[model samples]
Target: EPEVTQTPSHQVTQMGQEVILRCVPISNHLYFYWYRQILGQKVEFLVSFYNNEISEKSEIFDDQFSVERPDGSNFTLKIRSTKLEDSAMYFCASTRALGLASAQYFGPGTRLTVL
Candidate 1:
């Protein structure tokens, strides 16, 4: 089975430094997305990307967050400035089809911790 992969399984950064989280989705998957889960909260959607453009984004994906598919197989999320509250597990997901009914495969996640 195909699965998504993330780098720097764990990250510890200062409160204001920039951080880039990377992901590689299963081959042939098209739709890509980013989601985060705070320590004690449910997973929240951040942004969705397709055909090199953002398809949908949540308010949480403010000016500070950005996503890109720098290569054919790799997708990345960059945070311009980290905040203490930004500490959480960020997940990368991908699906073959579009819309609410498609199934998405998620990466194990990158845990970002700010101090």
Candidate 2:
């Protein structure tokens, strides 16, 4: 079976430094999303990218963050400046459909460790 892999090299970052975690989801999926889970908390929606633009984002995604698809195969979440509280497990997913008719698919998650 094909496995999901996270490029941790892209996640290494220092506080106040820009960091990006790259995710490559299934090609046929049309909607891309990022969700986070703190060590002791429930999952939270961070942002959604569609049609080459951010279609929806949560309060957690502020001016310091951005999401983009630089190419057909990669979806990225960038933090302009890192903060200690930013540490968490970030999950990336994609779906060919949306809402009720859509089946969601997830990629391997990358953890963010802020110092």
Stretches of model 1 off by over 4 angstroms after superposition: none
- Candidate that scores best on lDDT: 1
Q: Per-residue lDDT for 19-113 in model 2, tens only?
A: 88888878777898999888999989999888899989999999999998999888898889999899888988888776668866776688898
User: In model 2, how large is the Cα lDDT of residue 38?
Assistant: 83
- Give me the displacement of residue 74 in model 2, in angstroms: 0.4
TM-score of each: 0.97, 0.90
For model 1, how does the per-residue alpha-carbon lDDT over 9-87 read when each residue is reduced to its tens digit? Answer: 9999999999999999988988999999999999999999999999999999999999999989999999999999999
RMSD of 2: 1.9
Give me candidate 2's TM-score against the actual structure: 0.90
User: Model 1 compared with the native: what TM-score?
Assistant: 0.97
The alpha-carbon RMSD values of the candidates against the true structure, listed in the order shown, are: 0.9, 1.9
lDDT for model 1, please.
0.95
Q: Give the winner by TM-score.
A: 1
